[model samples]
Target: PPATARPAPAPAARLAGIWQQLAAQNTEIADLTAIKNHFERVLAGRTWGDPVLLHGDLTLRNVLVQADGGVAVLDTDLALTGPAAYDLGFLDASLDFIDRWQVLSRGRLYDDAGLGLARMALRDGYDAGGAADDVALCRALRLLQRAAELGEHVQRTRPALARVLIPRLIHPYFLAAAARALGVG
Candidate 1:
């Protein structure tokens, strides 16, 4: 049987479960909450064009380079219909997360100029029209979402002390990055 595409959650609704998990963990990320509120306020009563098919979990890990120089996307289980910006934003945030993680874990920094060029190329390649702000907001949201997911993963898999410590150490960087994406201080 062919898989059916489900409608993705609305922007505000997308982060609801993450917020619940954060609350359960007693994580107080005020900046993340601010980003969410700002996203809701800005997108309220606004239309983001018609929803389109999305690679709901698009990221570097899900892509592969073929021998013929083409690319393949794996893990289509999360495929759905949503605003096109969602996928782009998710990819952007994923790259940012990787860059930050590398710096934190290995003390190595990727080329900021190259990353900037790549981001610019990505935006130019996509016909985003007037939705630049939408992309930015979605990027911020994805950062927060990724951070919460990391915390959850740590909680489930790591030792008790790590469960308490890793999230505390890692989440602030993600929150700050999200804040920067949203133009917050």
Candidate 2:
């Protein structure tokens, strides 16, 4: 836990504004409100352990392996204090996004078995204790947050003609994956 890490809002609260922006841009994604509500309810019922310093953005790109078999983390700009599960879930969701993004953008297919093994290793290596459900919940929330951010980005950067394609294609994918992570449909 680093002193530089800031405190973050609750997951549902963090998603609310982004969700509003995304839903405003694409009406099709409005149907995701139900899923969002479900996330709010689930999170409302859970008890997140004491806040701890977190890297905030824990993606593969931010991690380094040292020659002496040590590990290092980079990019503390998004560091925040929250449940330990947040970092674990953020890393898991990031890996999942990278795998799917490759398939969507480059038509490259990766082995699911390898990804599964990596996820298992992540879970095994972390001492999450009894917060396994919290981890899954955070993962689902992060996926939805990523989707909302992408939608907002596309709306801002893409041309009117091209703006709809990326969000339409990937938003639902993220939503479905998020649902699965939440143990829903």
Candidate 3:
């Protein structure tokens, strides 16, 4: 294991702000069974490899970009204990969300796909102790979590942006929620 990935926060608290904001607008399922199901699955999973002192809350935000096109990490909260794959996944997911956001907001001017190429390069950079599969899992987690945030954010306060964003999200959320239910990613 390496000190890169981090464990995801419990969904309830992570999504709490959103839930509060959407308490009025979101009339979907207050039953919360789906959300509960997700938590249950996440809590039941295990590492395919030995756990290491991971960089808890691992993501690109913790990785500083240097002027020379390199990175310097900050905030070693030291709570980073988990499988190395978790770090890979966390970085992938954060980068992916940022890329998708640019495209969603700025459209043609922002090349979201560049994130994919960057991810591959980063993956290659970490080949020494890399587990791309685990990284992919982390990335997917970030995507869906951030996506849920986007939904709650736009629908609550930024209705205009929500007009553009919500339509783009419907299908992705459906699949992500399904995958979460299965505990596969």
lDDT winner among the candidates? 1
Model 3 / residue 41 / CA error / Å: 10
- Rank by TM-score (best first): 2, 1, 3
Q: Which is superior by TM-score, 2 or 3?
A: 2
TM, every model: 0.73, 0.75, 0.46
Q: Give the per-residue lDDT of model 1 (tens digit) for 54-141.
A: 7788775665544333445689989987777887788787776644564245544444554455455545534553334477778888
lDDT of 2 by residue, 1-185 (tens): 55666787887677686578667656465437667778777767667776776778887667654434345679878878877788788877877663457424554443455445545555654554333447777788788777777766777777574355645676877888888888775
Q: Which ten residues in a row have the lowest lDDT in candidate 3?
A: 22-31
Clashes, model 3: 7
What global local distance difference test value does model 1 have?
0.70
TM-score of 3: 0.46
The TM-score, computed over Cα atoms with residue i paired to residue i, of candidate 2 is 0.75
In Å, residue 174's CA in model 1 sits off its true spot by 1.2
lDDT of 1 at 90: 86
Clashing pairs in 1: none
Model 1 scores worst on lDDT over the 10 consecutive residues at 124-133
State the displacement of the C-alpha of residue 56, model 2, in Å, after optimal TM-score superposition. 1.0
